[model samples]
Target: MIQTLKLHSLKWLCIALYLPFSLAAATLVGTPRGWRNIDWLDVFGEGGGALMVLAWTLLILGSRPAGTVSNLIFAGLGLIFVSLWQDNIDEFWIIPDAQLWDTWLENVPMPIGVVILTLGLIRWYQEQRILMAQLSKRERFRREHRSVDPVTRLASADYLEQQLDVELRAARRDQAPVSLLLLDVDGFDRINRRHGVAEGDRLLQALTDLLLLNLRDGDLMCRYGGDRFAIMLPHTNETMAVIMAGELTAAVSHFAYHTHYEGERVRLTASVGLALALSDSPRALMQRADHALADAKQKGAGSHASAA
Candidate 1:
């Protein structure tokens, strides 16, 4: 948290400067109220409110990375804190009637702070909705956090099956087609042997990124254990699925990977098999794609095949 706060040091510096400046201005230009004249109740209320706002500002800065949302939120909160701090100072000092700036300080920031804060919250909500939509494609209804692959950063095979069942049901009801594609890296074990296992993991991560680039927004990809991946395509027929499979295989074959340790170039290739859903259970669909993948493997590396 301390390191994260350091990233936004400039914002924090602004708060630090404003705090002392507010205090000093009130003390220098305003007459200090005697102890009997001070309203302790207002002091407690206003000062406590300022402290609370300060704590909130620190939490927001420490938790979020420096960005538009962070900046807007910090700016808004900083303004609110300033307004409250000035209000609290009023309990100890009485500004001369001639000085209108103190009145401006007390009145200006509260409403403007609220408006800016509302805008920041709206933007933050929109961001969360987009993230949830993307996550839905990968995990579907059973959004178990553990159902994500640690190495590839894709959904796990179990998550793929769960989403496949949902898609299959929806396809059957709407009379729309769905497709499943199973892809496996060709001779992945040999790559792991030639290059270190760490390098092999990096290769898989890179390939995952490549495959994602070739897929549509609605397509779901998952890591089906080591060197194997599964994709679920909703509202797609066998023809489109086969074309997508070929594109993925071609992309993998053309990808150039270098070993992190030895700095040696590594050539990568993938084989893909596709099956269209037609009154088929999720297990049957998967089995068909798996068989098709075996057939593709027999054809040679970087080959794509489709099931009848």
Candidate 2:
């Protein structure tokens, strides 16, 4: 309480000094002469500056998305607001009459703020474009984090089924084609045995990155199970899925994986299965894909195979 009283006493002393200076200033000869009778102009102008400072601080601190363009826009507007407040405050105080420095103090920060805000915004746009490309598959998981897979950081099997269901209904209505591509590591059990489970986990992470790189923005990829991924292709036909499956096979077959502990290159392959909805429910569609993947596994042991 004593510290608070001391601070309050200091504040009162500052007010006492400033208040006398404020009262001594002669009123300006303006057409709206009645306006100078009250100190409302000074109060409002100072309030405005205080509010602008608050806004600018919030924008600068809160806009931390690494060059936030949206934040730049907000900050530029705040600068303009503060410049106007400074200009307004000058009307009440006529310190050393006819001084140009007061106007400069009011106006210079505006343009500088604009320049800084513009650069920040441009960088933000570039970063956003790059991010959109990198996490393109995550578009399907937008505004909803609950359905995302904790392990792979992609959408889960449940999300896949939900999306497939929605896309299937739309396809049936518009006569557009929608298909699913399932990919699983070939003999993942053996890899786990040879490299240990931790290494196997690293392989899965590598596999996830490779798959994400190969997929388009509209396509959805999910972790269906251990060392398995499912891709939902909207407005895609069986032939397109086949071609993509082939590409996935090629990408994984040639993927050069290095173990962190051993620094040894571990090669891995994936078996893929393609399934078209074909007027089936989401459950039935998944069953068909599962069976197709099983068929691909039985026929081939080391390479990517397709099911009938």
Candidate 3:
């Protein structure tokens, strides 16, 4: 522990090495009096710069689902924030001329921030490449705009129908089996009434992600209605599809959402209905799944059933 203590002490010592510069800056700012001839342009540039850096920091921290990009942006912004903060303080602090400390604070982070930002951009490029590859592996980013539900930004019923048609045709042509899954959140309307619209919207998005997570890459998922989702699968038989549907129901049942009003967490569950297509349109396949889902709901609200 002695050695570790010494190492940490040294690290902090290095940081303290910059304090003289900070103190000197504070001194300079206190006495820029009667120095109107001093570089006013520099003052304006640095002042505006300080504000911009602060804004960048806030924007980076405020972004949702922040990933590697956010971290990189934060670090870059932090460097700028520190530099500008020091510069702005120096505008009035009257540090002694011989100290040369104020100059160090003003100039150091410029190079450091640029170097760090460059490295971050390099890594960001690599990350984008990996993401693009993953996206291409499953989806062409095909403007499945028709398939997506506009309200929740999830897959739409029409898109589901189109997908079912495509998958069914492909299956029939290859003599492969296809399955359709229909899932509806249990007591969703009651939850909407109790929790308000925002919470209801949150639940729908959460459930969409959960259901999509349980599907294979070859599956096509779409939002069927207000609280219902459908998935179309190729090369899947009834037993296998039913097993997946059961897993989906279980997955959704375990999802607990934290409500804003009471700050209390409540679990949301879904009842599922599955169907297998036998040379049919997307609508027919979905109809079968919907009927089966209705059956599951009638029997019990937290389970799954199927129709062929």
Q: Which candidate is the best by TM-score?
A: 1
* Clashing residue pair totals per candidate (backbone < 3 A): 0, 0, 18
Write down the TM-score for model 1.
Answer: 0.74
Each model's lDDT comes to: 0.87, 0.71, 0.71
Clash pairs detected, candidate 2: none
User: Candidate 2 residues 207-308, lDDT tens each?
Assistant: 898888998878988888778899888888777888898899889989999998989998777888778864778777777778888887886843444446
TM-scores, all candidates, are 0.74, 0.61, 0.56
- TM-score of model 2 (CA atoms): 0.61
Comparing 1 with 2 on lDDT, the higher-scoring candidate is 1
Best by lDDT: 1
Output the worst ten-in-a-row residue range by lDDT, candidate 2. Answer: 24-33
**Residue pairs clashing, model 1:** none
Put down candidate 1 lDDT per residue, 73-157, tens digits, no spaces: 9878888887888889889999886778888888899889988998998998988688777665566555676877889878887
lDDT of 3 by residue, 1-308 (tens): 34433433432353356557665647645565457645667778887887787665554355423466656655665566568767766665555666565677667876787777777778778886786554431232455555556556665777666667787898899887789888888888898898888888877877666676777766767677888877777889888998898898889878877887797786777888988875887777778788898899998888898884
Runs of candidate 1 with Cα error greater than 4 angstroms are 1-4, 20-67, 85-104, 121-150, 279-284, 298-300, 305-308
- For all the candidates, what are their Cα RMSDs to the real structure? 4.4, 9.8, 9.5
